[model samples]
Each structure stands twice: as structure tokens, then as C-alpha cells.
Target: MSGTKPMGTDEHDAARTERLRKAMRCLEGGQFAQARVLIEPLCDDRRADVILAHALAGSGRSTRAARMLCRLAHDNPTARHPAQDMMTLLLRHSRLEEIEVTLRATLRQTPDDIRLYDQLGEFLLLHGRTDEAIEVLIEGCRRHPSALRTGNLLAVTQNETGEAQKAQALLRHLLSYHPQSAMTHANLAHILTVDNRMDEALHHHARALELRPDDPHIHLNHAMTLLKAGRHAQGWPEYEWRLRIPGRLKYPAERLLPTLRQDSDLSGQRILILSEAGLGDMLMYLRFVPALVRRGARVTLQVPREILPLAARIYGVERVIDPLRPVPAHDWHCPFGSLPRVLGQTSDIIGAPIPYLHADPHKVLVWEDYMPPRPGLRVGLVWGGASRPGVAQAQAIDRKRSMNLAQLAPLATVPGLYLINLQRGQHARQMIDIPEGMQLYDPMDDVRDMDDTAAIIMNLDLVVSVDTSIVHLAGALGRPVIMMDRYDNCWRWQSGRSDSQWYPGLRIVRQDRPGAWDGVVARVRDMLLPARPDNP
Candidate 1:
């Protein structure tokens, strides 16, 4: 009986080990559902619980996974797996308070752990708490003077807080000691790029890439630097690495079409163009469809439902379909942003003829009555962009690219300008502060989709907006546009350009410094006052 018991125990142990191995493989392959099914039953096992928490996070149960990870980390502080997993889940959910508490508690238990300080500071910086992050990282560097990563993050936080010189000094100092550190070089390259020191930035960028050839982020940064320098010949190919970046939009590999070599024949080919990224991006990139059709290819565009009506009117488009519907048969597929790379586009060839898009004349006439017959310059105003609440990355961009109606106070003083409230979403409450004498019309209730917005724009004399889809809509319709750009602008705008090469007659009003919307508003006010002299 004892000999039989030993054999039975051996068989049971073998089965458990095999199951664990299979579950681990599933997790590594991103089959989180399969992994969760296998892991949930083994939660009693401590090692399995860590993997289970990860599976829970991957499967969108982030809050539950965070709680489980916190328990595991509290129970076993020596193993970093649980703490690392907890930090990732908490950051993704933007639970900043919980992250601070958990990191502080862990630091108390292991007071000398430099890694905890690095994690705390980096997480704060990611959430845009730059001042607090700098303070923590300074202390971290003081305690562990040899920690390169801590120093690097401190420098980055300093850069974010508008201390570019300090960031450069710290990064250069780090390089003096650890010249082989690819991260320090990359950070320095980024700061240089932001300062518009392209030649020096390219030198450091090349050095960093040389040191870390396998790093996708480094490749992505190099690509942008190349594009900024107008070296599109090399930049386009490097930009393909963006697909490998975490948290960026990922297309199905199987659906990706073969790269169209420069000036390659597309005759008889059926090409599918995906509307990737933001609405503005779709409007900007749709210009290439006609160019593709010129090469004799049948082109189909898949766009969001809201933009379908406008996108259907693009020249040379064989069909416009909803992205939610099953895609039609095609020989090749490409994301909208990838057209420049595939079609050999460059800065010199940009700004393909304007008036590529047209609004329905009937819809345009309908909106004319909506506008008051005021004897003034009609202007459309969009002060805010739609963004998800409580998301760190989205909030950060919104903070830079969006503003409250109150910030446009200078515009209210511009006489002979009839302002129309083109602002979308719940942010219209900001209009409550629109001084008693100033009148900004609100017809947003009737504005249903881009089709309606396009029609409304066609009726307006000019469109004044921050970086939003409205700017793209006006530009595509060949209406005059004034874009209020942030200090660190999008790549499509290119660097140090007051006028966009992609959109003819588009004027940019840029912030001289970050968060300085006052200057931009004042400039727009100054420009408007002279243009409309009939008011005063």
C-alpha cells in the first residue's frame, strides 16, 4: 500500500507541473483567456497566484488584479514580480493615490531599495506630476549616486517641468560616467530634438541607435528625428517600427499589405486603406487615395461611421465602408499614416491641391439660416477636444492641446467677429463665463457628425481652433483656418513652421512656451481686429 501511494503522488505531481508549464506558455504568448482558465483554479498556490493576477490584468479586470497583486507584494516583498505587476496595473488604471501608497509602503519595508524610488518617480512623471517626481528622483539620486536609471528619470522630469538646460547638463554628466548607457544618450537626444537642435540631436540619436540596435523605441524616436530633419528618404522605413511599440495602435499583421516600393505599379490591384489614429489623422491622410487611384489601383476606404458621409466624397475612392462592418476583399491593405512611406512622399511634394473635400450644398444652405445675419466676420471656435477622463496619456495631451472657453477671453474683445460655438462634448459648460456682453452662438445640438460639421464649416468665413478635428475639417474644405498649436506640436505640423505644407491657406498660432495659451489668444485677437475694421 505504501509503494502504491508513492507512485500515485509522483503521477499527481507530474500532472500539476505539466499544467503549470502549459499555463505559463499561454501567458507568454498573450493568450490571456486560455491562461486565466487554467490559472484561476490554482490561486491557492502562491506562484500561480502571481500569474493569475497578471492574467486578470491582461483580461481587463485591472482593479481586481491590482488588489490581488498588492496582497501578493505585501506577503512576499523579496520577490519583485508581484510589486512590478502591481505598479503596471495601477499605472494603467491611473490610480495615482493607490500607486503612491503602495510604493511608499514598500519603500518603508525596504528602506534602502533604490529600485522602489525609481519606480515611484517614473510613475509620477508619466502621470504629469513633474515637480513631485523631480523631488523624489533627486532624493533617489542622492541616496544611490550610481543608479543611472534614477538619474535619467530625474533629468527627464526636469525637462518636462521646462528645465531643458538642467536636463541636458544632468544627461551629459551621466554620460561622462556611463558613456555606454544607451538610455542616457536617448534622453539627451530627445531633449535636443525638443530644443530644435536637429543636427546635434541627430548625432546623439544615431549614437543611441548604434548602441541599442534592437530597441524599438529608439528606432521610433530616430524615425521622428529623421522626418523632422526632412530626411524622409530614410525616415519612412524606420517609422514602420511603431507597430512594435507597446500601447500604440497595432494592426493585424495578416491584414498588412506588402510594402509598395517607390513608384511601383499598382495596376489591377485592389487596395484597402485603413482609417487609423484620430479623426484629424484620417482627414489629413485621405488625400493619398486619389494619388493611389492615379496608379490604376482600385481603392477602398474604411472610416468611422461619423466620417463616412464626408469620406465617401473623396476623389478616386471606389467605396467607403464602415470599419465595424466586415471588410471587403482586397489584394493589399495599409494604414492611412503609412501612405507617405509607400507612395514615396516627401516635404517638397506635400500640400496636394486644396478643396479635395466638399460639403453637401443643401446641408451648407441649411446651416446658413442657423447663423444670425450679423454684419461681421463669421468664425467657428473649438476650445476643447473629446478625451477619456482619468487616462494619464490622454489627459496629458488634452492639457496641452485643449483650453477652456474662459481662456479665449481675448477673442471676445475682437469686434466685428461673430463667434459660433463649434466646441463639442460636455465642455460647453465653460461658456457660462462668456462675459455678459459677448455673444457666442451655440448650434452644437444640431451638429451630429463630421458631415454636419463640414457643412457648418463651409458656411463660416474662418475657423479658429486648437489642435482638433475641426481644423482638419476646415482645411479639407478649403476654408481659411487658424490653428492654435501647442509648444510641442504633432509631427504632421512639422517643426518651426507657421504654415502647414499639407493644408494650403492654413495659418498656425503657436504657443511660445508650454501652457501659454494667453499669447496665442492675444495673437489671434490682434489678427482679427485689423481684418474686420467695420465694428468699432
Candidate 2:
């Protein structure tokens, strides 16, 4: 203590870096005041500007942060952090023109920067400019020949945009050049899985796992492959890795119920099941509740309020509460998605079947005029699924699952079918664009929730929809439904089958090719107007 030494340049720099890290952690936790205090001292350091911008934004000065980030991005054209942070901020505000200008100007300033290309491609993709996004990513790959991520992005975009063969070829080429790339292997596995090439997909998945044994993403992909092929026993165990993946997990692993053995008895025990994922997932998995209830266990559901009115009446569900309520006293707590893994011993049990969900009699009567109270066959149509703006993976899936309502113009001209608008969210606006002569009965403005939707659905003769929550609602209600299945089907639909394994008698009109909904629509039209023809 008696001897004092001055801090050298390296030690001083190290101290500043640690301080910046602490500031970043504070920003992540939204302790904006503390982050600002820690970061203001480092304003002169270029590395700290993004963190400072975030701190400034969270502390009631978003405009200042935006201007600061824009200045930082313009000043440091080749730097990744400022540009990416600025892009993220611009996306949240949907300032499309400014985002394009900033990214293009920065790319011109530093054409060799790979991160700018990725950022611009992502921005374009988010805005539904898929063609431009593909071109940008392709050029990025051409320029940065050694860049793995750009090439992967191009391949994935190609796959999603109805060029599956081209995507497969590009991935194979990437593997030839970069044989050791685990991501390329995993991506190839996914494409093959979607193509129904189960054995080949499993091989690539195994290779990916061997290369990166602890990677949760590879493990999750592997799980999807096995489950898609109906290898449930193996799939369920690998699926446990989902809890370890970031963003996918809704709750902490410690709080989740431990694995319940196949033979274990929960006689008189109470269990709480927490909801996870989108409404469609909730509807699909809720069928398993009866399997749990049959074990002499009392089941409580913590779910979205939208489903509360319907879930409250499921045969075996003892109680249903909105997620805002504190989890009531229970012996075991499990994620809603976990029921299948824990209760596979009773696999044959399909729970309560055919109209497991019922509409309120009053709501049904109220909706008597919902579809023109006539003798004509009424059909419900849902052209789109839910929107998840910030979630890139989910957004990509939705693009594939959704279609323009205009494509159904062919059916608008069909005979004796009264099309009803069950479409919701931003997609419902497409009702105005339907064929001029076709009148769609829309009573959705007054509809409240799933229970209300179910009541309306019961008034229809059948439901016709894409892979949306509406399909699950119709199927679970035991209503005849024609699922407009995408070419790359979901895992539950299995591979190359017209009939559903889950919903028997559910007619599936699958696309002959990816993003080729025209074929599907044509098939559905033909089915509706069968060759038997007692008509005009």
C-alpha cells in the first residue's frame, strides 16, 4: 500500500472495456439510468455509442438515441454494431425509406462489409420484398465468396421462395466447399426433412450433432426430424434440448415439471400446465389434457384469456385461468408442450374426440344470421396465420403458410358455395379484394375470442383454411375442414398423406410444389364441384 504505480495504457484500456461490459448488462436489464451513468463517461469511445444510444432510448429520449445512432452509423460506415443497432431501431419504427437509404449508403461506402448485406437482406425480407432480398443476399454471397452466413441466407431464402431444388443444389455446393461447416449440414438436414427424405435427413442431422454435440439448435432440428417421421420415442428425449435454447423457452427449466415416468401414478395429485407458443399450438396440445386427467390427477390450465371460455369446458380440465393469475398451489408444474413426452405410455388415448370444444348455445343462436340463413352451403376461409413481427424464424414460416386471398378468385366463381370471412388480423383486409360478384358474409367485427369464433364456425357447413389457428379450431370442433396444406407440411401432418393422423375425415388439399397454392386451390375447387355433377 505504501508504493503507488500509475496504470499503463493496456491496463487502462482493459478497465474501460470491463466498464463498458457492465454498462451493456445494465442496458439489457433496462436499468437505463445506471447504464447512462456508466456509459456517459465513455462517449468519446466509439465502441460505447450503441450502448449509450440504447440507454438514451430507454430513458425517455428515443429521438435523441435515433439521431445519435444515425450519426454513429454514418460516421463509422464499416463498423457493424452501429449499423445493426440502427437497423434494429429503424425496423421497430418501420421507417422503410430511411432504412434502405442508410444501408445502401453504408454499403457503397464499404462494399466489402458482409454484415451490411445481411442486415439489408433481412430488412427487405421483413417488408415482403422477397425478390429484392434474394438478389441482395445472392450478390452478397458472390462478393464475399468465403462468407458462410451469406451463402446460407441465400439458400434458405431460395427454399422459402418456391425454389426448393435450387436451394438443395446450393447447399450441396456449400458442403462440397466447406465440408466441416456444421450449420450447412444442419440446414441441409432441415430441407431434406421437409422434402420427406427421412433417412438422408437423419444422416445429415447425426453428422451435425457429431460436429457440434452441445449445440441446442442442431439438437432441436434433430428432434423435429425424428418427430416428423413418427419416431416419437427417440424424438421426445432429444426435444428436451428445446428448454436450453434461447427465446424458444417460455419458462425457466428449474420451474418446469420434471419428467413424469410412463408408469408413474399421480393419483389425487394436482398438476399445473403452463401455455407456450401460438394459439394453434395451444389448441393442438390441449387434446392431451384428458390423458393426464385419466390418471386420477386434477389438471389446471394456465392459458391465454382468449381460450379460457372454451378450455374451461374441456371434459377433464378441473380449472382454467388466464396466465396473468399467479400459478395456483399445485404439486407439479409442466409446460403445455411437455404433456406428450411425459404421457406417451398412454399413446393410444386420443383424449375426447370430435367436438371436444363446443360453442355456447346463446352465441350460436346469436350467429344464426352469420352466413345468410339460407339453404346454400356456407364455408369459412382463413388465408393467413398470426403475425410475429420481431421473430424472424416465425415470420419466415408465416410467409410460407399464408397466401393472398385473391388466389381464391377461382373459387369465388364456383357454384352454390357461400364464402364466409373467418380471416382475422391484417389478413382480413383482403376481403375487399375478392372477386366482384362474390359476396363474403363477415360478422367477425363483433366476435370476441376463440369461443365466439367456435360459435360462428358451428353455423357453417364446413371450414376451408390455410395452416392457421382456425384450422385447429375447426378440427377440434369436429367440423368438416379442408386444410390447404403447404407442400412442406408440418410435423403433425406427417409426410405424403392426404388424410390426417390427428383429425380423421379431415380432407387435405396439399400443394404439388412449394408456394404453389394455385394447384391446391384448383384441387379444392374440383373436390367441392365433384365429377358426379347433378348440377348445371
TM-score of every model versus the real structure: 0.81, 0.82
Please report, in order, the local distance difference test score of every candidate based on alpha carbons: 0.79, 0.81
lDDT of 2 by residue, 88-204 (tens): 754554556656776776677667778778988988887879899999998898887767777888888888887877888888888888888999999999999989999999999
Segments of candidate 2 deviating more than 4 angstroms: 1-82, 85-102, 247-263, 530-536
Q: What is the lDDT of residue 409 in candidate 2?
A: 76
Which model scores highest in TM-score? 2
Error of 2 at 363 (Å): 2.9
Each prediction's Cα RMSD? 6.2, 6.5
- lDDT top scorer: 2
User: What is candidate 2's local distance difference test score?
Assistant: 0.81
- Please, what are the lDDT tens digits per residue for candidate 1 over residues 1-536? 35544457888778778888887887677676788898787778787887787666666665666567667766765656365665675455555565566566656655566777788787777766778888888888888776788889888777766688898998998998899899999999988887778899888988998899889999888888888777777887798788777755445667676555546677988989987877988888777677777777889999998899888887777989987888788888898877777666533234357887889899999999998686889999998887767676566677778887887877877768899989887677888678656789988888889899888888889999999888988998899999998886776677889998778879999888877889999888887885445534
